[model samples]
Target chain A: MIKVENLRKEFPLGRTLQKELATKEKIAVAVDNISFQCQPGRIFSLLGPNGAGKTTTMRMLSTIFKPTSGNIEIAGINAVTNSRDARRKIGFLTGSTGLYARLTPNELIKYFADLYEVSDADFKIRKEKLFDLLDMNDFQNKRIGKLSTGMKQKVSICRTMIHDPEVIVFDEPTSGLDVITAENIISLIRDCKNDGKTVIFSSHIMSEVDLLCDDMAIVHKGKLLYNGTMENFRSNQQESSLTAEFIRIIHESNAATV
Target chain B: MILKIFLKELKDTLRDKRTLIMMVVIPVLVFPIVLNLFVTVSSSFEKDAAMQRVKIGFVGDAQSPVIAGFLEMPAAMGKKDLIPYPNEKALLQDVKNDSLQMGIIVPDNYQEKMDSMEAVTCEVYYDATDLGIKDRAKSYMEYVEKSARDKRYKSMNLDETKFQVILTNYNNTASDKEMIGKLAGGILPYIFIAFGFIGCMYPAIDLFTGEKERGTIETLLTTPVSRLQILIGKMCVVALSGLLAATCALVGLYLSIEVFNLVDNEEILSIVRGILTPSFIIMLFLLLFPLTVFFAGVMIPIAVYAKSFKEAQSIITPLNIVMVLPAMIGLLPGIELNYMTACIPVINVVLATKELIAGTLEPVLLLLSFGIMVTLAMIAVFVSYRHFGKETNIVM
Candidate 1:
C-alpha cells in the first residue's frame, strides 16, 4: 500500500548578485496540497499533461526527492524518515532512467538484485520468470547499448520487478515506445495488480489510464482536480469520452483560477 | 554490498577503451618510446658538439715565430679553420655575425712589447650566449697565453716551470651514476604524482557524472544502499585505478632507463637497484595510497556537481595543472624533506620520494608526511560524502 498526504515541493530559483540583497527569493511550487492512496491489488493512475507535477510527486514517493511538507508512507514505512527501508519496499521506474550500456541485461538485473539483497535462489527464480514473461531470453546476454529501444525497455521492466517490491511506481514508462511495447507494459501493470501489488503510474495518455488504472486522479497546475474510481468517473461522464471529461475538468480549473 | 558495487564498476572500467588507454597502454608503451627517442637525439647532439669545427678569426699578423708555430701545431690541424682579417674591427664583425667562433687581436706592438719586458694584452672575443663558441674561444686564449709565456722564457733562457707559481686545473670528477641519480631525482616525483592524479580523473568523471548523464543515477538512488556505501564503492575503484597509474609510471620509467641503457654505468645501476628494494616499493605504495584517495575525493565532488560529462571534464581539467605545479617543487635543488615540508601535500610526497630514492630518507619525516596525507585524504572523503548525501547533488 502507498499513501501520500498534502505532498508539496518548492524549488528556489538562483539569485543574481546585483539583486541578491534587494529582491526576495523566488520559488516555483511544483506540487501543492495533493493527497492520494493506492491499495494493494489495485492500479492507481496520476493523470496529468506536461509540467503537471506528476514526475515530482513520483520522485517524492520514491524517496529520490524530499517533499517540502508532506507525509509519504510506502508499505507501512514512512518514506522521509526511514528512506532506506521504504526504498526496499518500493520499485521505481521511469522512461528516462537507463541501464549501464556496457553491462548485459543478465548482469544488469543481477546487479539490482544484489543491491536489494535478494538471495541467490530467489534472484534466479525471479530472473527466469521475468525473462520468460518479457520474452527477453534471445538478447539477455547482449550489451544494453546494442539493444533496440523495445528490447531495452523489456530489460528495464525485468530489472524494476526483480526484487518484487510491494509498491511499484512507473513515471511515464512507455512514453516513446512502440505500440507493441507499450501494450506489453500495460499487461505488466495488470499483472502487478493481479499479484496484489500496489501500482501507481503517471501518464498523459488517457487510453493507458483507461486500460490499466482502477482508481485515478486528475492533476493540473500542482493541484488535484478530481479523484475517484475509474468506474465512477466513466459513469459520471454521462456518455462523454474520457478525453472530453478531462478537457471539461481542465477548463473548469482554468476558469476558477481566472 | 559495497564490494558488489565495486565489482560492477570495475567491470565497466575494464571494458572502457578510454580507461584502458589511460590506465594501461600509454603508461606501458608511450614512456619507453619517448625516453628512447630523447636519449638517442641528445647523445648524438653531445657527440657533434664535442667534435665541433671552430672558425678562428685573426686581426693582425703573428708577432713572434713561436706563437705562429704554436698556431700551426699538428693538434690544431683539420680541427681549426683560420681566417685572416685586415683589422680588429673586421674580426669583430665576423664574430658578431657568428661566422667566426672566436676572434683574436694580436697587438700591433706584439714583438716590441716582449723585447721591452712589458705586458701586452691581446683581446679575444666570442658570443657569450653561444656556449660552444665561448668554450672554444676560451681554450684558444689559454693556448695564446702559453705560447707567449714559452716565447719569453726561451728568449731569456729562464726555466718556465721554476719561475711559475703552482699551476692548477679544475674539472668535474663525479661518476656518471651519481649524476644520473641527481637528474632523475629532480624529475620522477612530478611524473608519478601527475600520473596518479590523472588516473583518478577519468574514473571519477565516469563514475560520478556518467551516472547522471546516462540517467542511471535515478535508478541507483532508488536502491536501498546508503549514500556512504555508494561513495565507498565508487571511490574504491577510483583509488585503485589511481594507484595503478602511479605504478605504471614508476615501472615505465624503470623499464625505459633499463631498455635504452640510458643510465648505463654499473655504479648508477647498483644505486638504482638499491633504491628499488622491497622496502622502497612498499614505501612508494604507502605514500601513493592516500594521494590516490585524495585525487579520488577531489575529483568526485566536482564531477558529481557537473550536469554533463563534458562539463565535468572542463571543471576537472584545471586540476591537472594545480596538481602538477606543486609536485614540480621537488625539482628545485635546495628543497628537501623536513618537519615543515612534510606537512605539505604533493610537495611532501615528492621530497620524500626523492630522498628515499637518493638514500637520504628520514624515517620520522616519512611518517609525518604519511600522516599529513592521510589526514587530508580523510577530509576530502568526508566532503565528498557530504556532497553525496544531498539529494540534489545525486539526482541531477
Candidate 2:
C-alpha cells in the first residue's frame, strides 16, 4: 500500500539577482496539498491533463523527488526518512526513462537484480519468467540499441518488474507506443493488480484510464478535483461518456480557478 | 553493488569503439609512429646542417699570404666556399642579399697590425634572424680566431704549443642517461597528465551526462542504491581508466625512445635502466594514483552538470588546457620541488615527478605532495557525492 498526505511541491522560477532582491520570491507549485491512498490488489490512476502535477506527485511517491511539505508512506515505511528502504518496496517507471543502449536485456536485467540484492537463484527464476511473459527470449541477447521500439518496451517492462516491489508507479508508460504495445502494457498492469501489488499510474487518455483503473483521481492545476472508486465516478457522471465527464470536470476546475 | 555498476561501466566502455581507439590504439600504436617521425625529422635536419657548405665572403685584398693560407686549411673552414669581395660595403651587400651566408670585413691594416705586433679587429657580419646562417657564421668566426692566433705565433718566432697559456678548467661530466632523464622529466609529466585527463573525460561524460541525455538516469535513480554508492562506482571506473591511460602513455614514450635508438651508447642505456629503479617505478604509481583520483573527482560533477556529450566535451576540453598550463611549470628553468610548492596540486605533482625521474626525490616533499593531493581528491569526491544527491542535476 502507498499513502500520501498533504503532498505539495514547489519549483522556484529562475530570476536575476536584482529582480530576486527587489520582488517577492516566485514559485510555481507543482503539487498542492493533495492526499490519496492506493490499496493492494487494485490499479489506482492519477488522471490529469498536461502540466497538471501528476508526474511530480508520482515522482515524490517514488522517492525520486522530496516533497516540499508532505508525508509518503510506502509499504508502511516513511519514504523520505528511509528512502533507500522505501525504494526497495517500489518500482518507478516513466515514459522517458530508457534502457542502456549497449547492454543486452540479459546483462541489463542481471545488473539491476544485483543492485537490488536479489540472489542468483531467485534472479535466474525471475529472469526466466519475465522473459517468457514478455516474449523477449528470441532477442534477449541482442543489444538494446539494435532492438525495435516495441522490443525495447518489452525489455523495459521486464526490467521494471524484476525486483517484484509491492507498489509500482508508472507515469505515462504508453504515451508514444503503438496500439499493440500499449495493450501489452495495460495487460501487464492488470497482471500486477492480480498479483496483489499496489499499482499507481498516471495518464491523460480517459479511455485508457476507464479501461484499467479500479480507483481513480482527477487532478488539474495541482489540485485534486475528484478522488473515488471508478464505479462512483461513472455513477456520478451526468454525461453519456467518460471522456465527456473528464472534460466537464476540467472545465469546471478551470472556471472555478478563474 | 558498487562493483556491479563499475563492472557494467567497464564492459560498456571497453566495448565502445571510441574508447578503445582513444585509450588503447592511440597510445599503443599512434604514439610510437609519431615519436619515430619526430626523431627522424630532427636528426635528418641535424645531418643536413652539418654537411651543408657555408658561403663566406671576404672583403678587401684576399691576396695576402696570411689570409690565403688561413682560408686554404680545411680545419679553419670546414666545407666552406670562400668568395672575394672588392670592399667591405660589397661584402655587406652580398650578406644582406642572402647570396652569402657570412661576410668578413678584414681591417685594411690587419697585415700591418700583425707585422707591427698590434691589436686588430676583423668584423664578422651575419643575419641573426636566420638560425642556419647564424650558427655557421659563429663556427667560421671561431676557426678564424684560432688561425689568426697561430699566424701571430709564427710571426713572433714562437712555438704555438709552448707559448699557450697553462690553465686547467673545470667541466661537467654528467652522463647521457642523467641528461636524458632530466630532459624527459621536464617534458613527460605534462604529457602523462594530458593522457590521464583524456582517459577520464569520455567515460566521465558518458556515465554521468550521457545517461541523462539518453534518459537512463531516472531508472538508475529509482533503484535501491544510495547516491553515494552510485558516485563511488562511477568514480572508480573513471579513475581506473585514467590510471591505465597514464601508464599506457608512459609505456608508449619509453618504447618509442628505445625504438628510435635515441641513445646509441650501451653504457647510456644501462645507466637509464639503473635510474628507472624499482623504487622509481613505485613512486611514479604512487604519484599518479592521487592525480587520477583527483581527475575523476573533478570530472564527475562537471560532467553531471552537462546536458549532452557534445556539451560535456566543450566544458571538459578547456579543462585539459587549464591542467596542462600548470603542469608545464615543471618545464620552466629553476623550478624545483620544495616544502612550499609541494602544497600546490598540479604543479606539485609535476615537480615531484620531475624530481623522482631525475633520481633526486625528497621523501618528505613527496609525502607532503601526496597528502595534499589526496585531501584535494577527497574534497572533489565529496562534491561529486553531493552533486549526485541532487535530483535536479540528474533529472535535468
Candidate 3:
C-alpha cells in the first residue's frame, strides 16, 4: 500500500519566475497539504485538469521529487526518510519516460532488472512471461529507436514490471498514445489490480477514471477538492455527467475563492 | 553498482557517432595529417629555393677588373645571369621591377682604387621582401672581398695569418635532446590537453543533458540508487573518454614519426624515440589522470544544469577556450616551472611536461603540481555533486 500524509512540495521562484508570475512570493507551492491512500488490489486515480499539480504529486510518490514537508510511506517503509529502500518497492512509469534508443528491448529490460537487483532466475521467468503477454518477442532484439510506438510502449511495460514491485505509479501513462496503443496500458492496470498490486495513476481523462479506478481524488490549484471511493463520488454528483461534475467542482472552487 | 552503470554508459557512449568521433577518430588522425602536410610543404619550399636562378644587373665598364671578378666567381654560389645597365638609376629600376633580382654599381676607376691600395665601396641593391636574395647577395660580396684582400696581401708580400690578431671558437654545451625539449616540449602537452578537453565535452553533455532531454533521468532517479553513485559512475566514463582521446593523439603522433617516417631529422627522430620510453608514458599519464578528472568535474555541473544538449554545448564550447588557454603558456619562451606556475592548473601540467622532456624536472615540483590538480579536482567534484543533487538542476 502507498500512504501519504500532509504532503506538500514547494519550488523556489527564481528572479525570472518572480517577474513572470508578478508575485512577491519566494516559493511556488506545486502540491499543497494533500493526503491520500492506495490500497492493494485497487486502482486509485488522482484526477485533475492540466497544471493541477497531478504530475508533481505523482513524482513525490515515486520519490523522484522530495517533498518540502510531509510523510510518504511506501510498502511500510518511510519513503521520505529511506527513499532508496522505498524505491525498491516502487515501480514508476510515465508516458514521457524515454528508453535508451541505442539499446534493444531485451537489453533495456535487462538493465532495469539489474538496477532493481532482481535475481537471474527470476529475471528470466519474468522476461519470458511479459514478452509473451505483450507480444514483444518479435521486436525484442530490435533497437528501441527503430521500434514502432506501440512496440516501445510494450517494452516500457515490461521494464516497469520487471522487478515486480508492490506499488506501481503511472503518471499520465496514456497522454500521447492512440486509442489502440492506450488499450495496452488499460489492460496492464487491470492486470496489476488482479495481481493484488497497489496501483496509483494520475490522469485528467474522466472516462478512464470512471472505467478503472476504485477510489479517486480530485485536486485543483494544488488543493484536494474531493477524496472518496468512485461509488460515493458518483452518488454525490449533482451534474448530468462525470466530466461536467469535474468541471463544476473546479469552477466552484475558483468562484468561492473570488 | 558503479561499475555496472559505468559499463552501460560506456556501451551507450560507444554507440554514439558524435562522441566516438570526438573521442577516437579525430584524435587519431589529427597529428598524422597535420605533420605530413607540414613536412611536405617545408621540403618543397627548400627544393624550390635551391633551384631558383637569380638575375644580376651591373652599371660599369665590361672591361673593369670587378666585372672580371664577378664573371670568374664559382658556379656553386648559385646560377646567375649578369645584364649591363647604362646607369645606377636603370640598374635600380630593373631590380625594383623584378627584371633583375639584384643590382650592383661598380665605381668608375675601380681598378685605380686597387692600384692605390684604397678601399672602394660598391653599392648593392635588392628588395628585402625577396626572401633569400639578400643573403645570397651578401655571400657573393664576402667572397669577392676575400679575393681582393688576398690579392692585396700577395702584392704587398704580407702573410694573411700574421694580419689576423685573434681567432675565437664558439661551442654549445647543451645536448640536442635538451635543446629540443626546451624549444618544442610545449607542443606535446598542448596537443594532449586540447584533445583531452574535447574528448570529455560530448560525452559529458550527452550522458547528463541528453538523458534529461530524452526523459530518461526521471526514471533513472526512481531506481534504487543514490544520486552520488550515479554521478560517480557517469563521471568515470567521462574521465575515461578524455584519457582515451589523449592516448589516441599520442598514437597518432607515434604513427607520424615511426611508421610514416614523416620526420626525417635523425637527431629529432632519435630524441622522439627516447621520449617514448615506458617510464615517460607512465609519468605523463600520472599527470594527466587527475587533470582529466578535473575536466570531467568542471563539465558535469554545467551538463546537469543545462536542460538540453544544445544549451550545454553552447556553454561548454566557450569554456573550452578558458580552460585550455593556459596550456598555451608553456609555448612562450622564458616560462619555467617555478612554485607559482606549479600551483596553476593547466599551465603546471604543460610546463611539467616540458621539464620532463628536458630531463630537468624536480620531483618536489611534480608532486606540488599533481597535488594541486588533485585538490582542485576534488573540489570540482564536490561542486558537481551539489549541483546534481539540486532538484531544479537535474529535472526539467
True contacts kept of each: 0.87, 0.80, 0.75
Please give the ranking of all candidate structures by TM-score, highest first, separated by commas.
Answer: 3, 2, 1
DockQ of each: 0.84, 0.78, 0.82
Which window of ten consecutive residues has the lowest lDDT sum in model 1 chain B? B174-183
Error of 1 at A76 (Å): 1.3
Which 10-residue span in candidate 2 chain B carries the lowest summed lDDT? Answer: B69-78
Could you tell me which residue pairs clash in candidate 3?
Answer: none
DockQ of 1: 0.84
Stretches off by above 4 angstroms in model 1 are A16-26, A237-240, B62-78, B88-93, B116-120, B127-131, B150-183, B259-262
lDDT tens per residue, model 3, B307-361: 8999999999999999999999888999999999999999999999999998889
TM-score of chain B of 1: 0.89
Point out the worst 10-residue segment of candidate 2 chain A by lDDT.
A16-25
Higher-scoring candidate on TM-score, 1 or 3: 3
lDDT per residue (tens digit) for residues B140-244 in model 2: 666657777777787779887786588789986755555655666766677777788888888899889988898888888888898888888889889888887
TM-score for chain B of all predictions:
0.89, 0.91, 0.91
lDDT measured at residue A117 in model 3 versus the true structure, 0 to 100: 95
Name the 10 consecutive residues with the lowest summed lDDT in model 3 chain B: B61-70
Task: List the candidate 3 regions with Cα displacement exceeding 4 Å.
Answer: B56-72, B83-130, B148-157
Output DockQ, candidate 3.
0.82
